[model samples]
Structures are given as C-alpha cells and as structure tokens.
Target: MNREAGMILISTMLMLALLALLVVSQMQTVFLVYKSLNRLVDKHQSFYQLEMIAQKLSSFNNNQLQAACLVTEKNPDEVFTLLKNGKACSLSYEQQSFFYLIEELGFFPCMQTVKEKGIYSTQHWRLTVLAKDERFNFLQLRIARIAPFIRCEKKPLVFIHTGIISWRYLVR
Candidate 1:
C-alpha cells in the first residue's frame, strides 16, 4: 500500500475507536438516570401508602376508634386478625397489602381539664404505628388525641386551650 493510504487508514481507525467510547459513555449515563428515576418512583409510592394509613386513622369515628383500641389493647394479636380477617371491615380501600409489613403499631389517649374560662389542664398520650420494608427504611406514625374535662352544674361552659407537643421518630 501507498504511504498516504496507510496513514489515512490509521487515522480512520482511531476516530472510530473514540466514537465508540463516546457512545458507550453516553449509554452508561442514560442507564444510570433511568435507574435513579425508578428508585424515586418506588420511594414515592411507599410514601403514598404511609400517608394513606395516616389518613385512614384520622377519619376514624368513635365506633372505629373503640374497635381498634380494644383490639390493640386487649388482644394485640387479634388486631392483625381484625385487619386481615376481611370479615367485617373493607380493606380494599386502604391498600392493605402494601402495609402488611407494619412492624409496630399502637394508640394512646390524652385528656385536658378546664378549671376556669380560657384556661386548660392538659395531659398527653401517644399512639404509635411502625412499619418496615426492604424497599424502604423504617416508617412510623403517631396520632395524638386531646379531650377536655368539665364539671357539671346548673349550666355548663366549654373552655379553650392551646399547646404544642412534639414526638420523635426512630429508624432501624
């Protein structure tokens, strides 16, 4: 072969190699982005499930409260049975399957008494819910309830009270 032809062939091969490297690098970046997006979607779904559980608890009426309270306190094991037995309550609406791995759960009571107008005697109780999944870390839910105490006389009056309490979260 001629000298000029040989040099052209060498240059063309080098250019092809560089082009292949660039393409591979671009593909790797795209793959990493796709993986990150998938992880984010999974995390969002898990968080949605957790929030739904909280909302369900919030919507509980007196009857539901009494039932759940009794089950949890008296027969803790039965709480799962009530949740899973699927005999009386509607579990379809709450996405029960996603929460099947709940690791911890509980409910607590709180009270406040008003001795005078615009005053309150405050007390606190805690209800805790905990769950863990392989896809995510520990998830915990805590609900706080407040009730006012009053004395009955010829006439009864209600008092207003305000306070802020904080709870802590632990992950394992």
Candidate 2:
C-alpha cells in the first residue's frame, strides 16, 4: 500500500508538470496569433489610407496631380499631410503614411498622322505609390497613365483633362 501511494504521487506530479507545459505553450501561441492580427490590422489601415489618397489624386485635375507628383519626386521621403476642412489632417494612431511619385514615361503617338495643325499632346506618366504602417511594413504600387492636354490654344477655353490609368500593379 505504501508503494502504491508513492507511485500515485509521482504520477500526479508528472501529470501536473505536463499540463503546465501545455498551458504555457498554448499561451505563447495565443500571444503570437494576437501579434499577427494586430500587424494585419495596422497594414489594412495603411492600405485604406493609401487607397483614399489614390482616389483623391485620380479625381484631381492635371495641374494639381502633376504638382503633387513633382513634390513627391523632389523628396521621395516626404510625408504629405492631407488637408481636411481647410486644415492639415494629422496621422491616426496606427501611424499610417503614404507617398506617391510620378515619373515621365515615354509617350507613344496615339494618332499616326500628326501634322503641324495638331494642337493636342499626350503624355504618359509612371506613378509609384508607397504605403507604410508604424512597423515599417510597406506596400508598393506602380501605375502607368496617359494624360492628353492641349499644349497651347489661342482661345480662352480652359480644357480640363484627367489621366487614364493604362496599367497598374503591386510592386511588392
């Protein structure tokens, strides 16, 4: 009877040790999952912010869009503050940030017959967008666009032109 009691106590201690280890491992897995989810949330927020900016840019006129692109080209690392309600908007708690660059890509002649009488010019632009969160997890996109505008006109009519995205893709 004494031997049986001793065996039972030892078995109980081993079982308790195994249970503790299992619980510890489960807690670690939970922590890892939580961290991954948190990162995913941050990335989604950054992507949403970037999408908003892209949508706004798409709506902008040629001059406004070009100006913004030039600013990005001048300083690639520039953190542009968005304007809201006539004021500069601040970043959210997730520290989501994004910037875009526009490069002059070679333009192809849309019309074969281009005489001196033709007054319209088509320009292609290569746009690169980079978005990041606080953790530096970044998303990159490349867009090719064609913008047609009148270079010079005698009339006072101000013709507005919007760029059309020819090709776009995620870089990384």
Candidate 3:
C-alpha cells in the first residue's frame, strides 16, 4: 500500500479503538446507575411496607391480641414461643413474613389544639417491627411511637393520630 494510505489506515484504527472504549465506559456507567436505582426502589418499597405493617398493628382493638402483646413486652422470647405453637396474638397482616412487638410506654392527656376543644387521654405505645424477604435478601427493622386517642368524640372524629412519630431502619 502507498505511504499516505497506510497512515490513514493506522489513524482510523486508533480512532475506532478510542470510540469503542468510550462506548464501553458509557455502558458501564449506565449499568451501575441502573443497579443503584433498583436498590433505591427496593429500599423505598420496604420502608413503605414497614410503615403499613406498623399502621395495621397499631389499630388493633382485640383484647386477646393486646394481652399477648403485653406478654411480649415482659419477655420478647414469648412471641417466638407462641408463634411456634401457632398461638401468638401479634398481628401479621399478610404472608410477607413480618413480626412486631408492642410495649405500653405511658398514657397522658391529648395535646390542646385550636381545632379540637375537648382533649381526652391518649395511650402512648412503642411498636418495633421487623420485616424479612428472603428472595431479595432484605431485612428491615423499624420502630415507631404511636398514640391512639383513648376517647372517641361525638360525630365520629376523623383523623390519623397514630403515625410516624419515630422511625429507625436496618437494611441488609
């Protein structure tokens, strides 16, 4: 081949290699971003699931369930023991495989608010919830302080009193 033609071929080969490298680098970056986004989505969904589980547990009104939770407060191991015997009263909402503990912290009068004139007593309960998903190797631990009003107001009061007072997380 002529000298000029050989020079052109060599320069073109170098440019093609550089272009391929850039494309590979870009693809790697995109793949990493996709993986991180998937992880973020998993964390977000797990958090929401934990919150929903907490809400369902806090709204429990069953006497036997409450008594069982009290048992757990004194000794958490009792929960596993009861669960093994299929006699636990702790609420499990779905087949998601989750467990929660309820501990009665204290009770006090409700906060004085401009909207509501009559303020009665409120029960302070601490709820610790743990959820596990073996498929994704995911586990989340969340703790919340929930206060459900002890007294009902006239006209069926409509509000959410038990939610998101405190939260902690453990992701694996």
For residues 40-126, what per-residue lDDT tens digits would candidate 1 score against the true structure? Answer: 998777666655654564434445343434232324344334333432223233433322222122321223344534333343323
Model 3 lDDT on a 0 to 1 scale: 0.55
In order, what is each prediction's RMSD in angstroms? 8.1, 9.2, 7.8
Which pairs of residues have clashing backbones in candidate 3? none
Clashes per candidate, residues 3 or more apart or on different chains: 1, 0, 0
What TM-score, to 2 decimals, does candidate 1 have? 0.54
Which of 1 and 2 is the better model by lDDT? 2
Q: What is candidate 3's TM-score against the reference?
A: 0.62
Q: Per-residue CA lDDT of candidate 3, range 39-145, in tens?
A: 89987877787778766666655364655554324444444444444443334455666655566656443431122554444445555556646432212222223
- Tell me how far candidate 2 lies from the true structure as C-alpha RMSD in angstroms: 9.2
lDDT tens digits by residue: candidate 2, 35-151: 999978966766666666665554444565544354222232332222211122222324545555555554334422233544344544444445543333222233334334344
lDDT of each: 0.44, 0.48, 0.55
Q: Largest lDDT belongs to which candidate? A: 3
Q: In model 2, where do residues sit more than 4 Å from their true spots?
A: 65-68, 71-97, 110-122, 132-172
